[model samples]
Target: MDNHAITTRGLTRRFGAITAVDSVDLDIPRGGVVGIVGPNGAGKSTTIRMLLGLIEPTDGAGTVFGEPITRPKRYADRVGALIENPAFLPNISARANVQSMATLRGVPSDRVDDVLEIVGLSDRADDCVSKYSLGMKQRLGIAIALLPDPELLVLDEPTNGLDPAGIVEVRQLLRRLGDEGRTVVVSSHLLSEIEAAADYLVVIRFGKILFAGPLGDLLEQERRYVDLQPEMESEIEDLASVYTNAGYDVTIEPDTVRVVIDPVESANLNRLAIENGFVLRQLIRSNENLEDVFLRMTDANTEVAA
Candidate 1:
């Protein structure tokens, strides 16, 4: 059995002069929540649409569960997707809406209630979709996607238009789904939301992938620095000079000098500073968060493109 839920090679889509998705390759491993993040117009949605067979690729090839994406019907039944807002009959109850969808998909009607419970909408199952909040509507969309009992679930900005609480709710729901052994691909512009929900991340910029891997691995690629505050503020520059001469990137502040180095090399940094007669007040590792990593990678890509 293939370990990947989704895979693509040279997936490209062009709109006359504009390339919405450039030559891109992606590997979405089976199980766990994978987040696809990109700036506006970075081709996140376009790539997803191609993967779901909603749009045909202009070039390249892809597979969902090892079935060719070009032959969508061959694998469509095993995958479920929620792209943009789910349209439901405004006057109908959530349950009825799901039932209609279940009917269309040939899913067992009994699974409607099960999906409703999965998305925390069982209590409001009788409420008309028009009366439901944006968050509730998103949940209903997810329930509909779940109706197929899909092995791979693809969601595009599932938390869009959601309030803070709603965002948290959706985040937790996606995490729980991944925990239940479903492979989930969730696209989002919000870095914080993805950090909280996803284990693996794919970051794209200007229709090209900037970074893709386990979140931890991406963070690890970012250089860790040791922040050192010396008792004598004037010694900051001298310490920075010493570290820079020793092949480390050094940033000097009012009372501290930050040197980019591995955590294990902190002892060497301290020794270098003490050898220069500068007493240290504090020494700590500055860990880069996901936002930092994302910004750095995307900004670097922008620079390269320029």
Candidate 2:
């Protein structure tokens, strides 16, 4: 079997004149959570649909468990997906909804109970889906996906409509699934949630990959910004101008200054400040996370488009 649980090469999908998903490549390994993040209309959903074989790609090809995605039966039992907001039989109970999935997929009857428990829906398993809260319904959708006990789980906006408590619950569930040695892929527009839940991230913009790797490594690659806090407010502008005159991007806040500088520039600025007799009370280098990277990349794209 291929080591990668999911692999896509030049995946592209078009809707007549508009290209919903452009050429994209991704490889998700086993036993880890890979977060897919992008702005609205950035092809995150389109990519998920293509991966599930729900929509055929206009160009390129992909595989789930090394089997052609186009041939769903080849790896259908090994892949579980909550493509989007799932449709349920509102009149029936949550457990029944999952049982229906098991029936259609020829999954074992006992698996429904197991998945409901896994998603924390066992307490209200018998509750009619119509009466369940949005968060509960979301869990039911996941229960349906897990009925087959697939090795890979794909969740798109799993926290959508979830309350704060529900969000935490879902995050914990994803972490637990990863601990059990199952490959997980989560797609969301919320970078903060991704930062907390995902180990690695694949950030896409305008349907193209902007970055792909461990979250920590990506932040390390970007220039570090130093936040400086000083005692005197009146002298802050002068201190900022000192760096700005030296060609650094200096952003001054109420009580802090955000100085974006490369390593070489950082060294020079530090030396220059001391030489000029500026008392620097505090200075700390900041390594930005996935959220910062996402904002920078997406904002740059917007500027280019404008």
Candidate 3:
């Protein structure tokens, strides 16, 4: 087994003259969970398809478990994937559906029961697929994928369309699967879900790599700022000038002056306000959520340092 589960360089794909996935590079390591996240149509699915050897890349190459993706047979047996949407025979029982897939793959029917428990579908395994909720159906897809006992599991937007509880259910399952030492690659647009579930994060937008690194490292890249609200609204402009004149990036607001500065420099901001004879009623440093950080990065259209 390779230390890296998948790797690509200059990977590209085009739909006629329109490039869907630009020159993208990826190095996905084995074990734990890796998240390939971006806005809708940011080439997440295309990249996965290329890796799965489902679609040919216009340029570059890659490998899975050290086997060339061009030769899927070399490694196909070890990879299980639930891509796009999972459509099961609506009329049949979940157990029957899972059992049918298991039989097709030459996997013993006993494995179906094991997988049902793994996905928390044991209780509804005998119920018709038509009676299952969206979340339950998604789990059935995962159960089918697990029947083969794949070393690498690829799930594209497994939590898409799931409700709050369903999202939580899938999130916990991903964490459990990763802890078991399997390489799980999941792609989703929901930043919160990925933030809570993924160990490594790959951010992409407009068919390009914005960032790819450990989740903590990406969070660390979010800039810190101090928000100062003067007691007198009239003094807001003057207070903002104090930082601007000193060469700090400052944004004037209706009541507060937003200063982009290291949190440790918060004391300096207070001193500056006091020196400028501006009374501050409130001064707070706000922490940004993942959505805030990601939106800012993508809006700037700049590559984030890995």
Candidate 4:
């Protein structure tokens, strides 16, 4: 068996005039939660649909468990997916709903109990789907996906429309699933949620992948800059002139001057300030968050594309 749970080479998809997924090459490994994050219409959905073999790619090829994505049946039984908001019979019990789907899939009736427990829904297993909260319903959907005890599980926008509490519930559930050694792929536009839930990340935008690697790798590569604030409110403009004279892209805030240079060079700014008779009120090195990094990357790419 291939070590990677999924791999794609030049995975491309087109919808007439628009290319929904553009030459994506992925080597997603097994046994960790991987988040595919991008803004809406960034081709996240289209990419995953190709991985699931629900839609054919326009140019490239991919595989699930080394089985060609073009032949989903080869690996479909080993995978479970919650492509979007899950649906269930509102009048039926959660157990019955799961059992019904399981029966249709030829999955054993006893698997329903096991999956419900995995999703923390055993206590409410018999509750009518109508009475379940959105979070509970989401868990029920996961239980449905778990019916086959798949080695790879894919969830699309799993926390969309959920309140904060619901988001936490799902985040914890993804962690639990990862801890059990299942390869889980979570798709979302929320970078913070992905940072919290996924060990690895594949960032996409405008139908192209921007970055793919361990989550820490991206954060570690975050651009670091110095935030300097001067003591005198009146000196802001003059202080900004100091860095501008030194060939830095300077941003002058209401009370501070920001230079787009490495934080390590902050000492030089301080020295320059003092030489120019400016009193430094505060100087701090800061790192941009992952969301900022991703946005900066995609936005830059957008400008280049245009």
Best by lDDT: 4
Candidate lDDT values, in order: 0.88, 0.83, 0.87, 0.89
Query: How well is each residue in 16-105 modelled by candidate 4, as lDDT tens digits?
Result: 999999999999999989999998999999998899988999998898999999999998888888887888999999999999989977
lDDT of 1 by residue, 80-152 (tens): 8899787789999999999998998999889999999998899999999999988889889999988899888
lDDT: the better of candidates 2 and 4: 4
- What TM-score should be assigned to candidate 3? 0.86
- In the range 121-226, model 2's lDDT, one tens digit per residue, is 8889998999988888888888887777778889988988899999999899888887888888998888888878788888888888777778777767665788
Clashing pairs in 1: none
In the range 84-150, model 3's lDDT, one tens digit per residue, is 8887999999999998988788888899999999998899899999999888889889888888898
Error of 3 at 293 (Å): 2.4
Task: Give per-candidate clash totals.
Answer: 0, 0, 0, 0
User: What TM-score against the true fold does each predicted structure earn?
Assistant: 0.83, 0.84, 0.86, 0.87
- Candidate 4 TM-score versus the reference: 0.87
Q: Where does candidate 2 stray beyond 4 Å?
A: 227-258, 262-287
**Considering summed lDDT, which 10 consecutive residues are worst modelled in model 2?**
261-270
Model 3: C-alpha RMSD to truth? 3.3
Tell me the spans in candidate 1 whose CA falls farther than 4 Å from its real position.
Answer: 226-247, 250-259, 262-285
